[model samples]
Every structure is written in C-alpha cells, then in structure tokens.
Target: MTRPDANPAPDADAARLAALGYTSEFRRDMSLWANFSLGFTYLSPVVGIYTLFAVSLALGGPPMFWSLAVVGAGQFLVALVFGEIVSQYPLAGGVYPWARRLWGRRWAWMTGWVYLVALLVTIASVSYGAGPFLARLLGFEAGPASTTGCALAVIAVALALNLAGTKWLAWAAIIGFSAELLGALVVGGWLLIAERHHGLGVLFDAFGAGSGSGYLGAFLAAGLIGIFQYYGFEACGDVAEEVPDPTRRIPKAMRMTIYIGGAAAMFVCLALLLAVEDYGAVIGGADTDPVTTVLTEAFGPVGMKVVLGIVLISFVSCALSLQAAASRLLYSYARDGMIAGSRLLRTFLPHRHVPPYTLAVAAAVPALVVLCSLLSTDALTKIISFATLGIYLGFQMVVLAALRARLKGWRPSGAFTLGRWGLPVTIGALVYGVLAIATMAWPRTPEAPWYDDYIVALSGAVVIGLGVLYLVTARPYERGDAPAGDAVPGGPAAAGTAPSSEPSTRRRP
Candidate 1:
C-alpha cells in the first residue's frame, strides 16, 4: 500500500506512459483513496445486497447466500489477473486498452464495444432499481412511471457531476463509500445482535420449492446474485490514467476493492437472510419483496424508511461511477478512431479534463433504456439481466485473451506480476467465468416465459453478433502513428513501422 515509487514527477509519469505507447493527456488529479473509492463505490455492497438479496433468497432459500462466498473466491482470481494487465498497460478504458495492447485493434474494438454496452445497461439497471427506494423515501407511489422518471433524474445528476471535474466525483464517492460501509456494519450487526429469527444453519437449507431446476438448479439460479454483485471492482482500472502512480496504486486498489467490498456484501447478505422471520410468506406469497418485509419487521416502518434513504446514497454513487467508467471506454476507443464520431468523442474539455461527448453518450443511452421501464418493470428486469451477463463475458474475454497471450510466451512484467502463477490463476478465473455465464444463460425455467429465461444470453449474443458484423463490414484499420511496444512479440507491424524483435525498440521516424 505504500507509494510504489517515490511520487514520480509528471514528466516521469509521462515517460512511463510513452513506453506503453500513449501520451498523458488527462489531468491526473485523483488521490490514492479516491482511486480506491471509485472501485469500492462502484461495487457498492449496500446497492448489491438491497437489490438482489431478496431475489436470490426466493430462488434458492437462505442457502443462496452460500453462492456469495463461491463467487467472491472466483472473482478474486479474476482481480489478480486484471491487476497484472492494468499495471503494465494502464489505459483509460480498462478492458479495451488492455485487449488492444495485448492483441490487435480489432480485438480491442470488440472489447470496448461489448464493455461499453454493459456499463450503459448496468447504469440503467442500477438507476431503475434505485427508483423504488427513492420513491419510498420521498413518500411517492413507486409505480412504473414514477420509477422511470426518478431514474432519468439520477442519470442527469450523475452525468453533470462527471462532466464537472474529478473533485466533485472524488468527494461524492468518498461520502457514499463511507456511508455504505458504516451502514452495512451497523445495520447488519444490529439485526444479528437484536433479532434472531433463524439459526445460522438456515444459510445451508435448500428450499427446493420451485418446479424448475430443483435444489441444485435453484442454487445455480441464485449464483446470479453473487456474479452480479462482484464485478464493479474492475471500475478501478477503468480510470487508471487519471490516478497518480497508476501502475502500483490501481492494481492494489483493484484487489482491495474486491476483498473489502466482497466481505461486506457477504456479511450483510448473511445477516439479512438470518433475520428472515417467515420463509414461506416472504418466499412464496404473492406480490412480496423480502427486503421490504425484513426491513419493516426488523427496524419498523420509520426505521426502514431511514435505511432506504441511506440506500439512495449508494444508488446515486453507483450511477455516477458507472457513467464515468463508460465515458472513459468511449474516449479510449475514439482516441484510436475505432468508433463513429471519433473526432468529437476524442475531444476533452481543456480545463475540466472531461470528454463531454462521451459523457453525454453515456448518460443518453441509459436514459433511453430507462424509458423502457415505463412500459413494464417486469420486461425491463428481464432485459437488465443482459447487463450482468454481458459484463461477465467482457471480463472472461480479457482473461482468455491474457491466457492466450501468456501461452504464446507473453510474460507479465508489470509493477505487479503473477510470474509462474499467471497461467493457473488466469485459467481458474476463466473456468469460473464460463460456468457463471452458462448457468445464467441456460433456460431452466420452463413454467416462466421463454423470452424471460433466455433473455440474458440471447441479448448478449445479439450485441456481440452486431460487433462482429461491424468488424467484417468496416474492416477497420488501426489508427495512430505512434511508436510500437512489446504487446505482441512477432505480430503485425504496429503503427506503420517494420516488425522488430522488441516492441519498445521501434521509434517514430
């Protein structure tokens, strides 16, 4: 956690970046904690648990909380692999830049395409989920229409803060992280200490009440909650360029975010599950939300409302971090002329160091998606499942790409490295990723509508399919005439230069 290298000067930082084939353009204004807070807030335990806890409990009973532990262990493997890549490349777009650096422009383009869609949809999903909590806090009926309205409002405010400067977002994330952490510990601990509705063994009870995917099937279904909750840790690497000493700090931040955030998530979820007073009513009754029932029973209505108010802080901060990460992805792609309107997206506000067009795109897409909630919240929920699946796919793609690169004799020499442990670690992460995606995508619910069951996989396939179509048709050429680096040892001549034995040996004409 110590400053990896004695606070390198701006010139030295710029030089380090040049070795990786990029110029330091943005304002490196974020401090160490702020950098760490970005990932922590994005992976907000409060938001994840409040939104998905009830759904998981219903699917697989209290035993569903076990999946949280399983997913956390898998994702920690993922974070380690990401740490190596981010430390070496350290680009604005976390996945995109790493993919492009390791492979080619085409691979990078697809990575950006899929990840950007995932982030935007996630913003919309997070916003829609927040609507009910906010409406309840404000004493309004949280109908479809009202929730959609609230989501749009949140999108606008988050975009504004992102466009202003790092200072605004830094403080917002700090406050949100602090509040969410304290709220989880205090609230979760109180529920365990004061109210003991069920024993600890309840977490292992497989309530195979559902017709589809009996006990084990429902357990897999419940894994969706943990898979969705763990991803925001990657948000740290998304803004790596803006953080000081990114090579050292961002990797550490990435791992700690998962460690601390994942633990908090598991603790809160276990506490809430153990506090469930009646499994039959909360899990099987018509038109019941377990979160609402448990909160009201444990803390009374007034206290529940107060807790919901704190949850709003989490929702708002999540929206802000997601939007920021998405915009950076856009800017990273556009800077290399990979996407349309690249000129505009590449433009950054001189003083603010913010890419206005990218931020606008980030907010606008989510706003449009939120509009769908007006039709049917149920329909929107099915569609939002795509967000979780898509993100997992993106993460897996990077892991696979890294493993492939490693097999081809690509050694990771970042400030952080796995050395001999790289191959096994990446392989383990990929196995977990593949299983998680397949489980979610499988059509296990025969009683439910077909569209609902296959929605996640179908939608993700469509998005990736579209990216493939663009790649084949446009046949996009690699842009930027910068000097090459050793991303690939014996690959194509990068940047209008002859192939060389070493990537960094090639200099500009």
Candidate 2:
C-alpha cells in the first residue's frame, strides 16, 4: 500500500503549524505509515494480550473474549471523536493542546497532567512486564532484582532510540509493527489450525467462573483486556507536529490503529482460548500460567523461546512509543509554561528537534517506578492497575471537553470531520469513557488487602489530588505565556491567516 502524503511539503506543514499559533519545532519526517506504525506498536496486541490474557481468562472465563469486541467498538467511537478533534487542532502533546483550545487553560493542564502520569506509568509497566521474558530468553533467573534490571535496560534502549531523532523513532516503530503483526498471524493461525482443543461452544461456557452475580460481573471485570489494548491509537495524534498533513493523516492513522490492532488482539485471544487444553484447571486457579503452558505444549521449548523473543521486541516497541508520546506531552506543557523548569524541559535539540530533558524525565520517572518493585512483589501489579484507570480518566476529560466545545457551537474545521455525526460521536465517546473508568476502578479483590482492591481508584485520586493542589497553589494557567484558548474563527484553516513568525509572548511564572 502506498504511504499517505508520500512526499509532503515541509513548508506547507510549517504553515499549518504557524496558522495554529505555533512554529514547527520538530522535523516533519513521519509519513502516515510511520504515524500509524507508532500507534500500532504502542497498542502492541502481542504485548497487551500476552500480559493480560491469562488474568482475563482466569477472571471472566472464555466469555472474556467478548470484551475485546465491546471495548473496540466503544474505542472506535473515541477514535472518531479524537479524529475530529485532532483534525481541527493538530497540535503536539495531543490531549493537552486539544483540551486547551477546546476549553480553557486549567482544563488542559489537568488533562495533560493526568495523561502524562498515565503514560509514564504505562512505560514502567510495559518495561517491567518485559523483564521476565528478557530474563528467560537470556538464561537468567527471573527474580525481582533481575527483572528490575532488565526493565531498566529496556527503558534505556528505548530512550536511546528516541533520543537518536524522529527518523529513528519512526523506523523503530515500523520495524516493531512488522515483527509483531507477523508473529501474531503466524502464532494465532498455527494455534487455530494445529493446536485447537476446544470448540466454538467453549466461548459460551463460563467454566463455573464469576462470583455470585454470575458471568456478567466476571466479564465486566475482564474489560481490562480490551481497554488496555485500545488506547495507543492516541499516540498518533500525540506526535502531530512530526507528521505531514497531520489534520488529514493523523485521523486516518488513529482509526486504522484501532481497526487493525483490535483485530489482531481478538484473533490472538480467540486462538489462545481455543487452544487451551484445561479450561477447568485454568478457571479454577490450578493453572496460573496457562499461556506459557499452552505455548510450551504447542511450540515445544525452542519454538517457545523464539516466540518469547518476539514478545520482548513488542514490549520494547510499546515502551518506546509510549516514551515518545509522554515526552511530547511534557514538551507541550513546558512550551506553554505550565510546569516548572519550562525552559529546560521545552528545549528542543537543534538538529534532532527532540526535547532531550523531557525525554530524560520520561525515562527517569519510569525507571524509578521500576525500582519500586524491590519494595514488594505486588507493587508492579498495583502500579499497572492505575495505568489503565488514569489513562481512561484522562481520555474522558478530553472527550468531555470536546462535548462542551460542541455544545458551545464549536464545529470541527479541518480536512476531516464527522459532519452531522460529530455531536453524537462525542457524546458516545464520553459516555463510554466514563463507564470504562468506573469498571476499571471497581473494587473486586475481596481476598486481598483492602488497599490492593482499591489501588486503581486510590492511585487515580492521589494523582488528581496532587494536580489539584499544585494547580490551586501555583496557578500555572495564570502565566499566560502561550495561547490559552481556541484560535479565532475556525482555527488556521478556517481563518486563512498565519500567526506571526515570532514565538508567542512569554510570561515568567
């Protein structure tokens, strides 16, 4: 397939940026394929399904596979809403800039803060999850210390590739996308053809799973499988400035990520579900590692090792894309003077056009998070639970802001739009986001400590509370160093005007 905007004009992209009241700081080296690849790799079906498949299967039985379809449809609506928003406001830092222009400074700050933290946590979680695979592949014992060390190593490698520049990042994403997709197809197809042990009826069988409320409660609890798999599409818009004709291409890339990534995830899950030989054992908690057991039986020891290597690559790419997204968000915040050390954080390399300091922070924070694993075995699990909740909350904030903007008569004015469907899509996305957040934060772990059950909600509250305290005391929005609200008329496209070559006036905090 031909790449979208195969040879886009840099001047045109820069002009679009200028019209949006900002100069292009990054190289527009990313084609639509590159953008989609970044999002796809971030979504990383192989990583998400591999990490959560066993847990989801154990929690919701074979019926849990349905959650992928349910959440995919809902997230498709979100992608539509986000597509319209990004088309109109194709700015770097995605949710932050989109929210700011749609609503106000305060709203944008909070949205960015929540989303930023979630991205960082996600980076840590992905890296940490990769630890055991890496250790296993390297013939090392997968203990707490070894796993943490491997996690740090993954973070470092991803950070170095990102620091190399936009071109390298795009290439890495494309490579990772290729390897992961091929691996999924080969493995999933082989499983269905050769290793299938259950019939289609297995999907309906609950295997005596679920609590007193029955399969309904268990299935909802397994929603994380789909919720976690669908998000990385937003990473496409996060690097808006790096993509040519972003208003048009970014939206397409976002949707493609969901369609293709969701399909891959569902295929893998279905294959794995059909291939499981002992549903009763898995569902009854006797088989804690059903995925490994199935793979070992199907592929034998050496083939399983090769699959593990592929899984490790997927994890690295996911972490790499996440780090890139997080850094762009931090750069966006700093560029707007919304955070301390704004000058340093916003400094883009003259040649590479990447924010080194922000990238360092993105890497450093996750590395520190990985270190937390030393304190307890379950720290990683608690940390990962917050990642999904925080991300959904952040997404809902943007969805809510877009709805508010629509009610105030803010029609999307860009190369792409939903036309009459805009309001309905926005409303649907918001509703889905809210319900997903509730499901993620619901306490279901009655057998564990109270804190473990409430970790998702508590972690989110802590992040939000700290953000509120800082917002109230520091009042970052009052700085007024950058454009705070929507561009006049219908944005750069509708206005048919360009901002001055000079940077927006800066105000000291």
Candidate 3:
C-alpha cells in the first residue's frame, strides 16, 4: 500500500528498467491520471455497453444487469493478480514480458503472439463498431460501404495521433476518459431520473427470455458485457515503460480502470434496461436496436446525435489505446529479437518516443481485418468472438504462469503485492478466466453454419496452432541475443539501487 512518487526521477525509472535487462527506450512522461485514462479508454464502457446492451437484455432480460457485477468481481481478481505481476516486472509488453520473466522464452513468445493478435483484432472490432456512429453523426446512412470506409478512416486518425508521440496518446486517452465518463453519467442519470418506465422489481423477472436449462445459460451467455468491459485495465501495464514510477503507479491504475469502468458500464446498462418502453419488443425480436430507439424517444434526433457523437469518441479512443498497446507489445517482442525484422520493429524514434514500424503494423493489421469484413457478412462477428476468447486465453496463460512461478518460490518483490493472498488471488483469477472462456467459446448458434457456431473455439485453436507452428519452424527465441527468463536476481525490490548496466543511447529532449 505504499504510495507512488508524484514525480519520480527519470534516473530511477531508467535504473529499474536496466535492472530488468533493458534500456529506457520509451519516454516515461505519462502521469498517473494519464495511465489510468489509457486503460479506462481501452475498457471504454460507452462502447461496450452501447454495443452489447440490447443483446444482453434480449438474452437474459433485466437480470442481465447482474452480469456486469459478476464479471466485474471476477475480473477484479484477475486485475489483482495482474497488478502483482506487473508491479514486480513493470515491463513494456505487459503480459508478454511478465510471462517471460515468470516462465521462459517459449512461453513468453506464444503468450505475446496470442495477446498481440487479440489486441489487433480488438482494434478492428472497435473501429468497425464506430462506423455506424460516425456515419450517423455525419447524417449518412450506415451501410457496408459507408461503415467500412468510416472504420478505415478511424484507424488512420488513431494511427496518426499515436505516431505523434506518447504525449499525444496520453492527451487523447485523458480526453476520451473525460468525454466517455461524462456522457455515461449524463445519459444514465437522465434516463434514471426522468425516463425510467420500469420498477426496480423488474430486474428479477426473467420475462421468459431463457432456454430450457433456465436463466443460468442465458445469463452466462449475456456475461460478455462484463467480461469485455473489464479487460482494458491490462493496457495500463502495456505502457509501463512510458510511465514514471510504473512499478507502483500502474497497479493502482489497473484497479482504478476496473472499478471506475465497471461502475460506468453498470450505470449505462441499468439505465438502458429500465428505460426500455417495450421489453417485449426487445426480447421478442421486434426491436433490434433498443438503445437507439430509447435514446431517440427520450432525447429526440438532435440530442440523440450528440450522444452518438460521444459514443463515437469512445470508440475512437478505444481503438487508439488498443493500437498503442499492440505497438508496445510488438516493440517488446522485437527488442528481444523474438520476431522477424526485429531491428526495424524495435527502432525507437527518440524524437517521438514511439516505435514507428511497430505502430504501422498495429494500424495496418487491424485495417486489413476491417477490410475483410467486406467479403462476408459474418466476418466481423467471427473476428469479435475470437478477439474476446483470445484475450481471455492469453490472460489465463499469464495467470497460470504466475501460479507456477509462485509455487516454485517466486515471491513478488514489488511495491504492490497480495502477500498472504497471492496464491488465493491467482487461483481465483485462473478459475474465473477458465469459466469465462468456456462461456464465451461455447457453441450457441446451432442453426447457423458449423463454423459460425464454433467460431470462437476454432479461431482460437487456429491462432494458437499457427503461433506454435511459427515458433517451432522459425525458432526466433533461440536466435535472439537479448536476455530472457528472470534477469533480476531477487525481483524489482533489489533493482531500485542496482547500478544500470544498459545505459540509454538516445539523448532525452
């Protein structure tokens, strides 16, 4: 529970990085608020709730609101586990570097690959989700062409801001966090106070929405709202090298992202559910877009447009944060010479404090995924399904690795740790991750094509299989000269005063 320094010295941050077997390549300019904002924006309650609200309600009725709290509690455990890991490691790539130090090079390589792919897909998913909002904000009809065009445009703008520097990224995240939180509060508060049509008792009413196995199946299916809303917290750790006193600050920011982001999401979902004028229309498939209908009825066209503008900002910010995290993970991989074109990918632009090549890949891959949506109508759905599943799988891998390390006597030596609760928290996180993954990957679309029904599981298997194939064939880990495994003798606790072995080559501005 030690407080992080308000403004830790650059030398201290550099020394910590060097102690972990790396130089200070990224500019440690992000403040505590900025770091929290990055994770908050990536979580993007506005985007997650707005996109999934109708689906969740249709699947589990008013009781679906409980899923937010359920997933939040579960993910908070995961966040606690992650906080301890990142506190000790405080590495740039988040999960990848933590896994490397906790486990080994092969484990780290696969973890990074799975996580990198998930981040890229999430970028595409967020960008694509923004298309309709952007198109509507511009007074245009949202169609395949318009949506795809807008999605690509969003990617370009986010990429431009990211390439500007960590400063611009921080600014964007702060702005996005402000706008999204304010919008959610204003809208949710308005609906609750002025537009609520249903009584509080309605939340317990199943309203005949679940299948034969009862509401449990439906509630679990609707759990994606909470599962997806809680993760962007890890993005805080993804930029650890860019934040001063990261070992102390990043852990707090991760927890803050979950607590604040979860509350905002619950507020939005609750307001939307209670404001629905016709629950039957939503649950019975008569009204496909209840969010827009309710907002339009309450706010009229002009006010609804304004809200859509806010939602669009949330989406853009989400995509931007995802891109930033993706670039950092790629940079981390290349820094260790673990991928093709390592030199160029790891090239740091001291002036901008950004990895330009990796940034391009981050933007380009998502853009390609967005474009692929043009070929098949279900492509985006499949991509989104896989994205969520892939993220959860990658997270569990890290949690599992941490547990293994702990059992082998790897005590966390950082500012923030669970102490006596480490094992229990790690176990809870792993269990939660496993159940959540099963819920997400379960085949629900029995009527659709077999591939569509099993998209989440199949896509995940394919991605992991491909990563294994490449790892075995390319043997990138063996060729890398960079330090691997636990480089620090006794963890970061011993790093603060340790003399820096790898001094930074670039001049600071």
Report the C-alpha lDDT of model 2 over 1-509, residue by residue, as the tens digit. Answer: 12344444777777767766677678888989999999999999998998888888888899899899999999999999899888878888999988888877888899999999999999999999898889888987888999999999999999999999999999999999999999999999999999999899988888888856777779988778888888999999999999988988999999999999999999999999999998889878899878888888889979989989889999999999999999999988887778999878888788898999999999999999999878976765677789988898889999898888788778788777888988888889888888899888889879989987888998999999999999999988766445545633354321123324455523245
Backbone collisions counted per model: 2, 0, 0
lDDT, candidate 3, 1-509, per-residue tens: 54454655888888777777678668888999999999999999998988778778888888988888988999999999999988888888898888887877788899999999999999998898889888888999988889999999999999999999999999999999999999999999999998999988988997888856678888888777777777899999999999988888999999999999999998898899889988888889999889989898889999998999889989999999999999999988887778888878888777998999999999999999999898877555566778999899889999999998898788888889888999999999999899999999998768888988888899999999999999999987665444455533454321123323553322111
Score every model by TM-score: 0.94, 0.95, 0.94
416: Cα error in model 3, Å: 0.7
Ranking by lDDT: 2, 3, 1
Evaluated at residue 106, the lDDT of candidate 3 is: 85
How far out, in Å, is residue 237 in model 3?
0.6
Residue 454 CA displacement from its true place in model 1, Å = 1.7
Query: What are the runs in model 1 whose C-alpha is more than 4 Å off?
Result: 1-7, 482-485, 493-509
lDDT of 2 at 189: 97
After TM-score superposition, the amount by which residue 42's alpha carbon in candidate 3 deviates from its true location, in angstroms, is 0.2
Candidate 1 per-residue lDDT, tens place, 405-468, comes to: 8877788877888877888999999999999889878887678788766777789889999999
- Report RMSD (Å) for each prediction in the order shown: 3.2, 3.2, 3.5
Task: Please identify which of the two predictions, 1 or 2, would achieve the higher lDDT against the true structure.
Answer: 2
Instruction: Judge candidate 1 at residue 486 and give its lDDT.
Output: 44
lDDT of 3 at 268: 90
